[model samples]
Target: MKGTETKAPGVPQALVDLVGDHFLEAARYLREIQDAYPKEFVSVAKKLKVGRRKAYELVRIDRRFHDLGIAPERLRQIGWTKLAHLASHVDADNVEKWLALAETVTAHELKMLLRGTVIDPETRAVVLYLDKVQYGIFETALLTAGAIKDSGCLLNREAALTRLLDGVVVE
Candidate 1:
């Protein structure tokens, strides 16, 4: 379960610059996790001592190696109640939100939401401003948005969102 290289050709220099060193580090971490766990999120979660909900949060926050475990078939097989059970281990409110969001979105839509704009302009601008003080903030926002879009569940979404800055390039 190696990480598939996501080489978006002609990606803007600004975006590439934004990605910088940390992106590589995060990517490496994801790859390591994939190699070790290989599509066994539940088992990995147990080994990490992360509750099911926390594991879902981690998966949602990062999709680079999400395919390692939690296949689409397995996800489809999990009923709402069971999904809720897993989510409840982290945050019950997030579980409901994630489930609801999942109902309205396709995987493509989730991907788009992660890399594209889903927030209003003013908010985006504010986030961009804040990100200048801390570059890592923007990356977290991007990841959190991806998590929310992908898992359809997120706790501290507002906090996660606060990390983004409007008009800022985050690779």
Candidate 2:
């Protein structure tokens, strides 16, 4: 993960230089706390001033990076969010490829790529915070439109939503 001279495409050298080593230091410290104080680990999020999820993420990043022997500077350049997304997928052999990909894409896009989703830069996401009743209605519509499965997984939500919208007859 370090000392490899191959530069990631679309990531400027200046941008990489702008990223500091603070995240790597934080990840290392968090990991130390996790290993030394396993019992008191639950309070780590409060201590770090981050949500529980983010605290755990840092620990995971540190552990994975350490185990994989990834360079701290390389991880710093990639940043925590992307590294966290990559932690589970990267191995010694593939770390550089994944890090390069992370550098070229947004974290959300990287997650999608890891999930086997094709990256379409033009495609966008829309989020809605629906109440229980509204969620039920929306779920039903998606189900009927074949966007979701009986197992409650999304199949092709964008296509389904497009079909649903296209069905509306204008006055």
Candidate 3:
């Protein structure tokens, strides 16, 4: 992905220049500086108030492939968890195939596909990248469904999802 392209049309050139892999490059440069003078990073972190992990994430995200096969815009849409998660499982030759599958499923769903030792494809699963309030609503919905069922069995994630998709089917 050395000369990889990003889907950043319509974005300001200045902002685009500042972010993306270039951002990673900058982070790498900073890490190098810190390596040269270890105490300097402490000052930089204190001034910016960024933790060691935040700085390391930049390096990690940078040291990774120049591109994980998905365009930058698609990456923005899917988020890093999915990209990094899938990238770890597939070799360079199969990265694109897995990434294509990633677009068809939520990041969480993709995780399930990659990591779930036994996935029941007959029973579909839905995964959402929801914010705190949104997750609260989802949790409430699951609880409500369980309360309504009242079958002396707990409403686990699958059962709740099945109830939600009772009349909905995807080909």
Using TM-score as the measure, which candidate wins?
Answer: 2
lDDT of 3: 0.57
Over 88-168, each residue of candidate 2 has an lDDT whose tens digit, in order, gives 998889987998898888898999999998888688779999999998888778778878674656777778877788899
Task: Give the residue spans of candidate 1 off by over 4 A.
Answer: 1-90, 114-116, 119-171
**Clashes in each model (backbone N, CA, C under 3 Å)?**
10, 0, 0
lDDT of 1 by residue, 1-171 (tens): 357643222223443343322333223333355555556645544544446664454444344223334443444443323333343232433544544555565443443344454744344313334545475564456565653534554544555554544335566
Local accuracy of candidate 3 as per-residue lDDT tens digits, 1-171: 554433211323443355444444445444554656454655554344446656555445444544444455655565555655654576668867776888787766787789774555675545679999997787777776663334534346667767767846765
* TM-score of every candidate relative to the true structure: 0.20, 0.65, 0.41
* lDDT of residue 52 for candidate 2: 70
Clashing pairs in 3: none
Model 2 clashes, total count: 0
Where's the lowest-lDDT run of ten residues in candidate 2?
Answer: 7-16
lDDT of the structure predicted as candidate 2? 0.73
Model 3 spans with C-alpha error above 4 angstroms: 1-58, 67-70, 120-171
User: What's the lDDT for residue 106 in model 1?
Assistant: 49
